[model samples]
Target: MSYTFAIIGRPNVGKSTLFNRLVGQKLALVDDTPGVTRDRREGEARLGDLRFTIIDTAGLDEGPKGSLTARMQQQTETAIELADALFFVIDARAGLTPNDRAFADFARRANKPVILLANKSEGKQGEIGAMESYALGLGDPVMISAEHGEGMGELYDAVRELLPEPPEEDEEPEALGELTDEEIAKRPIRVAIVGRPNAGKSTTINHLLGEERLLTSPEAGTTRDSIAVEVVYRGRRFKIFDTAGLRRRSRIEEKLEKLSVADALRAVRFAEVVVLMLDSQTKFEEQDLRIADLIEREGRALVIAVNKWDLVDRQPGQIGALRTEADHWLPQVKGVPIVAMSGLMGEGIERLMKAIEEAYAIWNRRIPTAALNRWFEQAVQTNPPPAVSGRRLKLNYITQTKARPPSFVVFCSRADAVPESYLRYLINSLRSGFDLPGTPVRITLREKANPFAHKRKRPS
Candidate 1:
């Protein structure tokens, strides 16, 4: 039962910078530009001996009703509602602005314990600004530099006073040891929703949550950070990550966009199953293929989601055509699951969830060693490795080293001489024979050492 704190401030007041410092990681995107964080990001924060949950929200600003700016403020307000306390941050170097004063009043109305943070208070100018913050009637501002790591001792003291005292500890139970297979299966699956800009990645997640958990707009690149949320479908829990829309490297010129793209890539690497969302109007594009290739290379289970299905003009064979295109365009994961849905309309959500579970099961599938060797023997006999450099390539045996992408190692003669075409042939055969669809399979070739070579037979 960790207490939660929401950091509230105007734009570019170093809220995200403070979040990164507290979390001890760059989980939230930080940039010089204002309004960089449109979504409220949460992280486990620790200071001295205190531990709690911290949420970094979008800056509070004035906007016309129903505009994007207004929606951003709504997100900040929601963060405020969920928090047990609030950290009201202000830029000490810039001093207090009218917006800061107005938001200070707003924070007061919430009636939560507010800890005023005068950020960027490192120089003489910052001290003057910190003094100015006292006029807002929010109590003495805790002067600190989020970026330069100054005055954290005073900040820690302020937060410590607000937290309740710890309860008495009971006797500890014995260690439970390793978890059973059934217990492990009950854990949440980590899935990442990624695609090109304006692909409705956030909309899909918002639909799943049945709330506007993330900010979505027609404008491309609305999301700049990878935001993770939990969802339970049919008694199965999923920790899904809504990542920034990735774009082609050549087109990304801005420093902020580059950071966003890097954050999305990190999400992919951390996810167990990656759902590549594509706009139905423009499915199977070049960038989509590249993203899929990257997922395969990373050895994660993949599911292709064709979003905005309602917008497409229905055809008799559209579903079948989508399957064919998925197999043809992306042959690496030949039988990858593809679900067509409208994220806005909430259509086909169940099918998408089912496909994700199925893909995850396949990714973790492992075959018995005996069955693997039998299949390996037949596959080799069907199309034996071609003779290389006038020497026969003898494939002795194959064994599955591990699962979670189903990796294998093959001991053979002249491992280096095996052609790339031969390896591809073996990999494809393994996929079809073992029912390993849509999961990346790895096969490593190792040369078998001759027994007589170690003995000095030439001396006789």
Candidate 2:
């Protein structure tokens, strides 16, 4: 029921800057270099009291067929088609360029209301460029500075005139009632597949969707941005984010490539479950371990996908060796689910999907306070706390604070004195006792304050 707007413009026109300002977060990567944004990222934006979905698209340009730049432009065209309106942004300081004039015509051809945004309009030169934007044939330009957060009120007013009014409180609500738990679970799960370049990330996604929705090529780094698509499997829907393959930081030097890597990282942080795709031929590499470690640190449910299974020789201990390697290299996420499949041949996909479901359920699993304290008592009795400074560390109680990675807080006499080994022992016990394998379990220690310390003597 929300309105959607696509912020379109030529390269280096501050579309991303405006997107960050509206969303109140740096969800999209911004750089001084042109064409840093190569994919369309959607975020819920707010200005004053108006709230809507805003999409930041790659700068419009004409490129040859099948080239990287061409694919970027195709992404922009797709955004335009899906948008309810368009914010055709121009660099007011640079005045109007041939690219701006040409894309203005493109935006008009979409047959949607276009709001001309003259960004970087803080000085006399910017004002001159804003006046020049009137020549593009779009309506009056709204001069603003996307970087310094200037002229948002004018932007809000222009957008308000184009948007439909919200229904009154007395009016009937959409669909008549709140959704049940089962009905709500029917919503798609947000899953992000990420790994090193040419790891068959795209191929695996395509095979799962049963269509060629994503472009696949043998060339490394073929996917330059994170692309999202929805698919229904066995009555459970999934919203999959296909991200660009990441390389080691030393190898990534290009400005555009850096942005793509940052985009993929953002996808990982936003996703509920992240599937780290690995090439079976290459097996476990340093970067693969790093990616897995990142997912663990981010507290997202993880599933290890050993892609390109078709090419590997079927050895007697191949699967076992692969799993052992996964556990050895990525000990941070112990017992992580590992599924080997050939994306080209579409083998073991069902098993992979099942693993994804299991991980998600475990990620959301929460333990009751009574049950948690019971387990904590047994765990502490089995392995007593280590003595620090010859004084036994007193462990008082434990309780689960939240789920979705299963966070807990342990109140003790001295939180700082708890040994790292003892904490790991408790974490492992909790994982095993609660049936929470392959999910990040966060246990924070807090010192119990003396309840009587704040009391004042009565009329003493």
Candidate 3:
């Protein structure tokens, strides 16, 4: 029976700062730049013994309909509609501005309990602003500094007064044991849709959701935060993340864009399967390859989605040509899944979902030790390790240490002397032999230690 509070204010008023403070984490990005948050982010928050859900939203602003700013305001309005109450924050140091007065009426229109917070009230100057905030007709203002953690007690009291009484407690259910593999598989799959700016990542996700759940525009970098939404495709649950478009480092001039890129990279690392969306017109470009390489380096399962397929001129064997190009560009992940589709028109969506599930299954695949060793024997015997410095490298055996991007370790006589070319050969052979395609495979080399070496070598 937790209540939800949506923090709303004009830009640069410390709304995100208060959100981080209540959630006890830096989940929301905070910056001096106003409108740094373009989407509404929700988190479970706690204050003293009280627990509630908190939503951090974009600052309220006015823009023409269909513009990005207007869309942003719409997202904030959605958050307000979903919340049980509103935390109308104001910059105490800046005093009340016309925008603040205007938006105060906006918050009033929501018809929910609103807690007026006069933030940044550390010095005497902030006190003047706090006094001015009282004239907005929302009620008394709680003077607090979200950064320095002041006035939280008063804010907590205001929030508790608005919260409804909790329902009667019920008998607690027995704690469950560890989940089995099948049960774990039943859980939602975390898939991240990532790519360069204006690559239709958000559009694809919106198509899957069959609604404009996320704010989308033709302009690049419209999405700043990594917003995750849950969807069911063919009865399979997937928690999909819509991330900001990644650009080249040289082009990332603004501090805000840098933060957005970092957030996107974090999504890649957090996801189990990543769909690298590419524009059909600019498929296999340098930036696209770089993004794919980063995904491979992160060891997440990879799927290549050629978006805006309708824009492309159709030709015979085009799909096969795309596959060939993918293998040529990303040989490390040979046989990766590639789906060509128009995100805007919702074409090839079923194939994209199918490819994602197959990639996930392959990513989590594990090979039996006996079969792995047997395949290793044949692979090593067929293409034996090359001798270096007139000494033959004796390869011993291999074993799978883990799965989820299957990793292995091979014991050998001279681990350091093993050529990368030989390792690549073994990796490719392992992929073909064990039916592991697209997922990143890791192999660590270890030198077999001599048992009698510790006995002083007989004073040789």
Candidates in order, TM-scores: namely 0.96, 0.79, 0.94
In model 2, state the lDDT of residue 432: 83
Per residue, candidate 3 scores C-alpha lDDT tens digits across 302-392 of 9999999999989999999999999999999999999999999999999999999999999989899999889988888888889899999
| Error in Å for residue 169 of model 1 | 9.3
Which candidate number maximizes TM-score? 1
How would you encode candidate 2's per-residue C-alpha lDDT over 1-460 as one tens digit per residue? 8899999999999999999999998767788888877767788898887889998998998888987778778878888888999999999999999999889989989999999999999999999999999999998999999999899999989998988995233444336137665765776788999999998888888898786556677889877768777778898999899898999999999987888898899999989999999988786888988888899999999999999898887989888887788878877777889999988898999998999999999998879999999999999999999999999999999988888899999999999999999989998898789888789999999999989978878995
What is the alpha-carbon lDDT of model 1 when measured against the actual structure?
Answer: 0.93
Q: For candidate 1, give the lDDT of residue 77.
A: 96
How do all the candidates rank in terms of lDDT, highest first? Answer: 1, 3, 2
Q: Kindly list the per-residue Cα lDDT of model 1 for residues 1-460, writing each as its tens digit.
A: 8889999999999999999999999999999999999999899888877788999999999899988899999999999999999999999999989999999999999999999999999999999999999989999999999998898899999988888875334355434346666876988999999999999889989998989999999998889999999999899999999998888889999999999999999999999999999999889899999999999999999999999999998989988899999999998898899999999999999999999999999998889999999999999899999997788899999988888889999999888899999998998999999898889999999988888887775764
Query: Poorest 10 consecutive residues of model 2 by lDDT?
Result: 167-176
Q: Candidate 1: deviation at residue 251, Å?
A: 0.8
- Over 4 Å off, model 1: 167-178
State, as a TM-score between 0 and 1, how close model 3 is to the true structure: 0.94
Clashing pairs for predicted structure model 3, backbone only: none
TM-score of 1: 0.96
